[model samples]
Target: MGTWDSLHKQHVDVFIRINLLEKALLGLLQNRATGDMKGAASLQKDFLKAFEQGMILHFAVEEEALFPVLARAGEKPRILISELLAEHKSIMEKHNMIVQTAAVDKDKILLELIRELADHAKKEEQSIPSIISQLTPEQLNNIDQDAKRLGYRL
Candidate 1:
């Protein structure tokens, strides 16, 4: 076989991380908050703490590295990248809300967070093919390194 030019390491890495986040969200969302209310609240709070930590790096790399490349590529791409950047901001805001919500309102906040994140991630997944096609392996590698520097693994 010839050299495998389609070596998309960064895309694969990001996808792995995204899949992990999706799994965690699915578990948290499917379980629903119940039984010992305090226990549920504590569980979600802990899960969210970890999730937020991971997403900070994830969002940074996308915004700081990936989006800029896409933004400069073309007008339609710039528009889409801007929308994604906005979504990143929105997701962070919602994440903060989830973290700050009172115990009594925790479940509702989690549900909303879940929905918003699901939508954001779905859009990202849909855009991945275009991104991979548009960006060179080296550029993606730079974004991947940036993500790693910000503490993302997988």
Candidate 2:
């Protein structure tokens, strides 16, 4: 396989992590809506921890490694990366809000946050593959190294 193909496989792993976060968020939202406040609170805490460690780290790798190569390839990576960062900010705000409002009737807010996260994951899954397909082997190796430095396994 080419370098891009190998890197694309690594990106798929990131997508799996994102999907896991989405599922956790969805479960928390459901529990919140169903009056399982205790369960919701616990799950929300766990979700936040995972999000910080997993999803955030994945994005950091992409921002530091993948996006720059794509930008060098004249693929509007700057704009895409900027948009993704903005979305990450928004998601973080919503997650914090959900944690703060867990004791209150904030089921709707939780649902909205979960939905937003799902959307963001979908966008990453769709965009990264095509971008990866265009990258050279050396570019992929750089991304793999960056991901490793960021504590991600290929």
Candidate 3:
């Protein structure tokens, strides 16, 4: 594949994984919210695994690799990148809370985390295409390799 096509594929892969995780989290939230803890633990386990395996990597790629590209794009993009980073911090905090707490009704916090992550993903979807287009072929390859090192399938 050509450079732009390859870059777009890798970038889109991250979004696809994020969307899957969000869907799983939302299902878990619905089950937990209903007080139906039957398979909730299993769902929780899977969701947690996905978060550990996927979401963290996505965050690192965006912050470490992609955000710098956006930052150089100018003031408005830099500001948006800053906002997205701040959202990641908050979402991570909630994720930590969800992982550490065994208390009942923690699905509430999981729901909150899902909402925060979904919003973050939407903001990224809006800005990432522009950022990707601005990157050089070498830069995109570096990003793809970095993301792979972080355990991204793409």
Candidate 4:
């Protein structure tokens, strides 16, 4: 099978992660803090922990497996990948801050991170298919193989 065919599963995994994060964000937004600061903080902490774990794996699969191949394809793909990498960096920094900051600061940063991540995912979903369509089956296979080696799972 070609790389895009294999990549569908990985994309599904990423979409799932994004959906979960979005759901978590929705929950946090719906939650009313009736002076239960500890409870609010607890929810934020749980969201952060889950987001960090999933994003680490998500970014790894893209950065290590997919980006390099796309970058080499041409200037457009390279530029796009560069932007995505920058977003990844920013997301990580925000994620780290959320973990370390006080409860008062956590919610703002967490919301920002999730919004940024959702935008990033949208860009990937919109752009990557066209870029990958230009690649050879061998190139696609390489990305698929690399992702598998890095423990990408559906």
Give the candidates in order of lDDT, highest first. Answer: 4, 3, 2, 1
For every candidate structure, what is the RMSD over all alpha carbons to the true structure, in angstroms?
6.3, 4.7, 4.3, 3.9
Candidate 3 differs from the real structure by a C-alpha RMSD in angstroms, to one decimal, of 4.3
Local accuracy by lDDT, each model: 0.60, 0.65, 0.69, 0.75
lDDT (0-100) at residue 48 of candidate 1?
Answer: 73
Candidate maximizing TM-score: 4
lDDT of 3: 0.69
Candidates sorted by TM-score, best first: 4, 3, 2, 1
Candidate 2 off by > 4 Å: 1-38, 97-109
TM-score of model 3 (CA atoms):
0.72
The backbone clash count of each candidate, in order, is 0, 0, 0, 0
Q: Tell me the tens digit of each residue's lDDT in model 4 across 1-154.
A: 5444445554565556556555555556667445655655565566666666656877888899989999998998999999999999999999878767676756667778877877887788889999988988788778888888888663
TM-score, candidate number 1: 0.65
Sum up the clashes in candidate 1: 0
Clashing pairs in 1: none
Cα TM-score per model? 0.65, 0.67, 0.72, 0.74
Which residue window of length 10 is worst by lDDT in model 1? 1-10
Pairs of residues clashing in candidate 3? none
**Which candidate wins on lDDT?**
4
